[model samples]
Target: MPNKIDFGNGSIDFNIETILIKKNNPEVKKLAQFYIQLFQNPNIQIQEVDKLEFTQKNSIILGINERRDAPDRYKIQVTPYGIMVEASQVKGLFHALQSLTQLVKLNPENKAGSIRIPTVIIEDEPRFSYRGMHLDVARHFFSVDVIKQYIDLLALYKFNNFHWHLTDDQGWRIEIKKYPELTNVGATRSNTLIGHYTDRPVKYDNKEVSGYYTQEQIKEVVEYAKDRFINIIPEIEMPGHASAALAAYPYLGCTWGPYKVANTWGVFEDVLCTKDTTLNFMKDVLNEVVDLFPGKYIHIGGDECPKARWKTCINCQRNKRRFNLADEDQLQSYFIKEIEKHLYRKGKKLIGWDEILEGGLAPNATVMSWRGETGGVEAASQNHDVIMTPGSHCYFDHYQSKNPREALAIGGYTPISKVYAYEPIPANLDPKFSKFILGAQANLWTEYIEDEKKLFYMAFPRAIALSEVLWSRKEDKNYAGFLERLQFHLPWLKTQKINLTNAYAELDYTLSKSGDDMVLHFVKAPIKGKVLVEFKHNANNFTQEYPKGDSLILSNSLDLKAWYQLQDNSLCKPIHIIYNKHKAAGASIQFIEKPSPKYFSNENSIINGIAAPTNKYSGPEWLGMEGKNFEAIIDLSKSDTIDQIKFQLYNFPAAWIYPAKEIIVEASTDNLNYEVVGSWKLSPFTQERYIEPIVDLKKNKSYRYLKIKVINHGKIAEGSPGAGHTAWLFLGEITVD
Candidate 1:
């Protein structure tokens, strides 16, 4: 009812009673069934006609329209007697059926069954032949059923490409007949790190976790995707991100001594040797991959290959000299060029991460720009095809909120607005480069993401935003209008059992301050019965006690209230609350504190200090780390007065553990550092945590600095044999009143 469906002719009335579908492909039967189920209305009778000669007077023709010579062309029209639908492909027929289903009423007013659609013409064609969504299955393996479901969702959104990142530093996820070890030994992991990344030695339960897709299973998936007109582009990362391959066969690496499928996330030093054996192994693996995927392009991950190992390897040095490469960078370029040539010879094109633009891009290679718009701009300007997926806008692992409690606690923040507002074409790029630019993609690197529900929660709304950006012109995208559409789709999403977190619900916060009295309020929708609220004088430094007293508890289906007094110009008590509810809830707070002096300092110095971390100081104040379990103690016992605390965290690694748990900041007046001041959980992926404690600080007292204690509720295993589970947390500036 939202919009009227129209064919290119005059408004017509017709009744569809019989459906005749004939095709040699078995998938066509599935398509036919899909259409039948979609349009199963009691008012319209559907009959499957096997032959053209058996068509009834009022039958609809549903088969390939070979005369048109268009694979996806479809025509839906109204005749004097009935509705006629024709297509050149089963997918096209299915699409037409979806359109028809959209036109009919759920419950018709009359059994006579008369439906009318407006006279509208739509000769729709894709802007880019490759509209893709890449999933890092290597970091964490999803079941075959989940993959199929993901495909179905992509098909629903009209996405045509699925770039399956099947191998990486953490694990290998596909079976190769020539190298059975790729799956048998490479697919499994010894242990995954449970906490954020840090120098601290952390440990997990140390259990083995692994999965792989068999050749037969891969074929089934490929066929399933083909029926939906979606091509599966499998990425077999080469030369680098080949820790798993090195682990499976050590001789493949430049070191040729020791390595394992990385248990933790992040780029490792181990890389594929440019030696003959390594190249041959890669060629054999690619040969097997090409047989499985019919997509014109094969992605060879060329991102994040560190030069540390290459610098020291004899074989790498030999390859560098053999290829007339000047340095390691040129060596990498030469290596990629060789692979590109191989793929080209095999009747396929090669695609790589934006890094392929480093030395000199391959002639016909495409680039997936992930670091930022610069790579994409560079690639397109050089007349190379590019797909813009900068981490700022398209990375789904960052925190989506300003509150520390709502983020994934690993990566930087990438709010819904940022994702929705992303323009595939950068403003600075040459206009000519725009033509070379294909559509964009939102990548879900599942290093920390564990389940499908969480994946759906993070993808939707954002995915919807991406879809509109890809399908509609940029000028047509209105934030408010998109929100309205999102509201409507929420119901459908619910029906599909998708767990989507509405960003609007998390933005409710109110603050008020009076003479010695201050108030703060927040609203939230929790799926569980209880949620925790922690109050801290200094959010940067705090600690948590396991069972109780760490946070306050708010109970019942009622508003929470707390009262406190100021002593020595500081709030006598900082209240923390935790509660459980059946549905979503909201919170409010009031406190008393004496006003302190306000002075304007150098904002640049503050910004610079807070934004970047070095050896002398930890990175940005907003930076939050998770990976290894460690206690961060912020000493607030010496400060005169505190106003705000900002944290900067390293970007979450491309793995499933980064999105697994909530990162919290606890505060303590003493170095022993105790009590929860502020807390944040991971919300998909956007990184940045800001906490402004409403409590008053003791003036002219010994309360100086604050401490931060980071806790990881056992999520991911360790990264390597000796490597501890870790996450990076950077600290910037602590603004005080």
Candidate 2:
């Protein structure tokens, strides 16, 4: 038998007359049929080949393959009678069948004729060990069947890692054998939030919201994934984000009091107790987890554990002292080390959020750097392996596009391009640290995410971007090419019932000079319904507000949408035009000179808000900015050179939802560019605050634009749900020197 059936090169005396699928597993017959269907070859015969005889022939075999390459490979061998493909498992046989099906093409003359597989010897393996897809069951719990379906999708994509985030402040999704109440009581929520976390006091009536996976179901899923060579890694949150756990067992908290699973998103003060009993409780949970998941790593959520509660807890204080700790921050290290030591004994390694680096990293611990690459850089520099999951790029909960209504309410906008352009490693980091960078992951925190549909809407195109990021080399990530490939996946997504926005392109409109002011408008796609048009000047800064309109219309909508002027008393009102609600619409802006000052009539107004320019100050949107490099281009060709730039920023919502970071500002000559002018760090400010920078600008030398870029240095201090800094940059009178 010959494996190659060459039709193009020359005629070959080879045939795949029969497929003998052998397995002790009872599904072998059904699987053989499936292969036959996949191959689309009705002529080929199927039979239960004997295991010993199949082994001798090196034919199709389905079982665990210990050989490294054999796990997911199809090995074809030439036989005297026909060709035989040895698959380590049924999945490999199915895949080999798919490959064989592709070799044949529909003949034009015959209408249907046998396609040919040319002589070829191909061996393939995954580029990355952990090609993974992470789902945040904490935000919105998917049923076991849904999870299995998700695994099916991962298998389709050839992804091998299924990271199940089972616990969060909002919900605990997996049942704990030792603590049955964790699912029965803790998993159920009174009511889920209806809108974005920024829209506070919008709570629903106490509706019972709940679901959990039993240990048996989890085992089934694990076996299912194993058959496909996919590893399921379960995450059990710890230390800081134990609200759900505390709700079930209040004794686990340092306060030793009740705490509800957090209704709103952001870090909470309540944390796990550092007592011996708490350690025992965690170990017991891990014991169950280790039994269920055979993956090498366990994610211990060591992120966003605020020190406020620990500073006040007597148990934490005692632990801090007992460990010879330097401060309250060190207590987290003490707690993590204890948990890591316990997991080590169970033959599992610890992986945690970058915040685990606060006190000191645990020995042999891997860091998932969510804040930014800084943590990953720090951890990698110290010889600890790091997974770069910076929230700026990897936090899928962030908005996928710049809809001010969505951005202001959801926190900030991370357009699709941003997600695609994200690089796991920062340019500033040493090249040697690259080895410590395992890969990256995207997190879909569900404070705002509620259903599987919404989850898919946010995850697909974004996840597709992340997949390419992790699988392909950095140099290969071309924005235009990626967009093209992304379009290809959209139809596939639709076929799979994924709810995704079909709008694949951004608005293309240019800014033009209109008298003293600049006019900017977009050639919008035809959208149905009343077109609630909104625009933001790269200048105006405002905090989150629900927009009020017809029905609940728009309440507290972003103020950035309205227009503003250098000497305006009234904020420009949003231009709402009624249009057929079924088709996308387009609009334009005509900036006419106003004889009198125009201002926003709303109660919240910034009169005479203009301040001197400074690198230290940022507008409201700049506060929680996190990234390694910041670049902005400000068009100053229309205005005179200025001596100062002023910015106003809102405090981190007391709710702990927004990101916090430092910022750098730059200047540019052509509208196509910019230059770094100055830098600034966020300072403590009550409510709305202002910062100013004094930079020397050449007199009468009008540059086209000014750009401000903010880089996150540390976690924002805990705040109320919507309290994070909302920065506003105001251009004061351009003092021509």
Candidate 3:
């Protein structure tokens, strides 16, 4: 229950009156400064002591021994007499200081109070050498001060790598001395997209915005992170997502000049020209990057480079022939290999997104897998070092809460639970290549994160979970215990001024169905704090806790909200789950045509009695049909009188999820012949909105088998998220009476 004290026997119950430093090291002095800043009593001071002494009163001992076995390992031994920390490296000492900071508890007055900590001999070191976190400043530029704060947070958590994403399609965020236009033109954008990329007819703010890091500023950040034992790995995007660089220098583009920095999100066709001149430009930029970062790895972004322009460009086509490349993909492989060779000349290893694995991987490239675990598995199997940063668990831009009231996110749900549950190492990976799997990283892409506050909101809690994932051994993780510990750590984040999501009011509920009988199960979500839940059934509102060891058997519709009382004596936003009762609520429903992989996994979702979650697309729920009509057979088991059937569909034009063309429900007493009970011509979706289509049942029929058919919208028109691709028809719970 006490702040995790790793090792020792006796307890140290002394107030910090003074710190006796055994070494006159700058890092050790800085550690003392940080400790004083954190627990400022105005009475404590640091004194240089010649000999090591363990006094009981109010003194702390800090010592450095060069003969220590572990270079970055620290030891903190506690006794009733004194608290002593010993380490051979600054990294270990800093970690010991971090532990010391945690021991300084906040008192009732919100001031720091020295307390007794368990006297455990803590000898700790990082599990992985490359524990890292990534930030995409190109999407939305964060100031130098903010970047330092991010690094500070990482250092506090013992994360040692800072992946600075400095270039992307949206903007160029690093200064290149040779190319003044890079910062002057590429870093500046006319405006930004006003909503999620899935929204059709994208709107812009129409305001000029510009930001870039100067060489001096970059040096400051590098030095700042270095003090915390953090390595800054600068990322320079290439080939694809080079709209900004091309906009600055028109000749770098495959097409003509006069390209503007992309104000929108997502991958674009415009790319860096595949020529000697372009290669020179990249090498020049990377040369400047090399001078800035001391880390051994330089990230040349080899992800999401579109080949459309390359297909048309004469120079690219000529290069394809020159290298005898099979296709544009192989051309990309050529590009990456060339750059990797360039970086090798500069004594740095090339690291890239998993997309670099396409066609053929470079001889010594490190892969950062973002799409899924398969890329990491594939890369590692080939004896290449891989960093497992799969988006399902590591993307902080995704929504953390399932509550619709959450801020507009890029999309997809990645709650703290999901991040904490992720295992970076793939089970299918060969044991011979297991050593190639370095570690994992969580990325904070800033397309929707305009301010530092919102950015921290998205990164925190999830990053905290990822920290444990990357640091602790796989078998040591326990969610219930973690939740308990995190509850205590929340205040520390507040003290550090982090804008973390409370999620206390979010509700997690499930529907248990047996035949026609249905029961509602509910619990507080996210933080899972103390909750009092209430439900409204059939227009009657019952406000109180549900009975213990009992479930609510719903005769009709069920509406539930789990409310968590905050410190202000008011409930945060209640997580709302609204479900309508259907005649076939618990009936066995099977889809004749399987749903698309993009939108489904669990086949029981259609008959689980739970409706589709509203916040995002594609969870374990929501059966979606792409370019195929949804035909479902529901077995009511026995003959029952049915009057009306109702179902729901989604309409998001930007995502290419259109309203179904039509819906027809037929009932049959036997398995063969069926009589039409309800039918409707569903309206086309011209805009984005979720719709629940209820076709009034006209015929009164006694039936055992109900066949429901929902027609897909077919091909989406031009200018949608998946334009020219088959529109998806998403089906939720089908309720028949």
CA lDDT scores, all candidates in order: 0.62, 0.59, 0.80
Instruction: Identify the leading candidate in terms of TM-score.
Output: 3
TM-score of each: 0.67, 0.65, 0.90
In the range 1-737, model 1's lDDT, one tens digit per residue, is 11223445565555556656564656656666555554554444445455643345555566565655565556666555455676676666665665455345322332234556544433333344456777888877889998888887787666778889899988899999888888888999998876555423565547787999999999999998887778888999987899888888988987675787788877787888777788888888999999889889899989888888888889889888887888888888888888888899899999999988888888999999998899889988888989888988888766565443453535666767777788888899989779888878888888777677777777776777776677555556676677655665665667678877555324233323222222334433221112233234334533332233223232332233222221112221222232222111111111111111121122222222122332212212233333343333332223334433443333334322232244454444554555555555545545423222222333343344344333443444476222344533323333333
What would the TM-score be for candidate 3 when compared with the true structure?
A: 0.90
Give per-residue lDDT, candidate 3, residue 503: 60
**What's model 2's lDDT at 364?**
84
Stretches of candidate 2 above 4 Å error? 1-125, 404-409, 473-475, 508-737
User: Compared with the true structure, what per-residue lDDT tens digits does model 2 show for residues 673-729?
Assistant: 666655556555523323333344444545545665534333333444423443222
**Which is superior by lDDT, 2 or 3?**
3
